[model samples]
Target: MRTESVELTVLCLIHKNGRYLLQDRIKNDWKGYTLPGGHIEPGESIVDAVIKVVVKRKKIIYRGE
Candidate 1:
């Protein structure tokens, strides 16, 4: 059988100052405060996924790095 491509997503939520990041998708399938991450290449680890999402979404530098 031919292999089918798949996409994966993850959310790394960060709560600070008594608030959290939220996203409202157009699909309306889901709505809420969520640290969203997704569509990372295969062989990538969870930590990398989180960092990629946080940096892209928040535009904040990773101090720990």
Candidate 2:
């Protein structure tokens, strides 16, 4: 029997004034406008993963820093 591994990922939807935020991906394999998100790192919580992905992808400044 063969086994398949599952990977965990997260996606976030930011809505403001009836508008939603999306990312315009230019990579060859993933070229298109899509939601901003990424895979969760090992031992990382879902909330932390969401924050990290959003900040890294969108270049959002951390107000708590």
Candidate 3:
């Protein structure tokens, strides 16, 4: 017997000053705009995963000032 697995992800609403940001659908699965998100890695928290994915996609990093 074999076990199947599924990856978990979280979608985030990026916004600024009452404006909401979204991503343009480029995949064949869905059409139109979508929120930014990615798969949750092993031993990674929801918050951490969100930040990591967002940073990777946006190419922005925080220095924790």
Candidate 4:
């Protein structure tokens, strides 16, 4: 039996206040202050993933270009 694995990442665009908001790997993965984005789950789009992470963390909505 092969165990499938999924990877999640975060990408952040910090402001000039020297404040960075990224993700961190927890266990055997790259669990650290990554950017402000993550992997896309089934049925979830790329933009959705980023928005979820950023809004959930910073409590603000972003209108990406």
Candidate 5:
């Protein structure tokens, strides 16, 4: 029997007016503009994961809905 591991990730789209927020990835492997997001931590909710990633990468804070 063989086992496979899966990783969960999330991406958020923040748009206002006619513009959307994105990150500029200058790394050699992946170089381009992408939305702010990252892999979800273990035992973390989807919403929480997205929030954490967004804050860490984009420096944006969530103020609740």
Candidate 6:
């Protein structure tokens, strides 16, 4: 059997004031309230993905590591 290992998606825990960002994954194998995430581009660092995908998508200015 052919097999391959790769980094695909990233989940982020973003909290503001008193709320945790989440999503309703209403498709595929995901069904319910789940953390926000998306596909990680090839050669992209996890930190960059978090900032570019999750943070940018939400439009929330994140200023901490």
Please report, in order, the local distance difference test score of every candidate based on alpha carbons. 0.70, 0.87, 0.82, 0.64, 0.86, 0.84
* Worst window of 10 by summed lDDT in candidate 5: 56-65
TM value for model 5: 0.83
Clashing pairs in 6: none
Point out the higher-scoring one by TM-score: 3 or 4: 3
lDDT for residue 54 in candidate 1, whole number 0-100: 77
In Å, residue 35's CA in model 4 sits off its true spot by: 1.7
Quote model 4's TM-score: 0.44
Candidate 5 local lDDT, 11-65, one digit each (tens): 9998779999898999989799998888998999999898888876678866664
TM-score of every candidate: 0.60, 0.81, 0.72, 0.44, 0.83, 0.69
The root-mean-square deviation over C-alpha atoms between each candidate and the true structure, in angstroms, is 3.4, 2.7, 3.1, 4.8, 1.5, 2.6
Model 1 lDDT per residue over 1-65, tens place: 89997887777676779977665555566655455666676998878878777786658677772
Model 3 clashing residue pairs (backbone): none
Candidate ranking under TM-score, highest first, comes to 5, 2, 3, 6, 1, 4
Candidate order (lDDT): 2, 5, 6, 3, 1, 4
Minimal lDDT window, size 10, model 2: 56-65
lDDT of 4 by residue, 8-58 (tens): 554657564787655566766665555656566777766677677677755
Q: Which prediction has the highest TM-score against the true structure?
A: 5
In model 4, which range of ten residues has the least summed lDDT? 29-38
**Candidate 1 lDDT trough over 10 residues, lowest sum:** 26-35
As for TM-score, the candidate ahead, 2 or 6, is 2
Location of the lowest summed lDDT over 10 successive residues in candidate 6: 56-65
Predict model 2's lDDT versus the native: 0.87
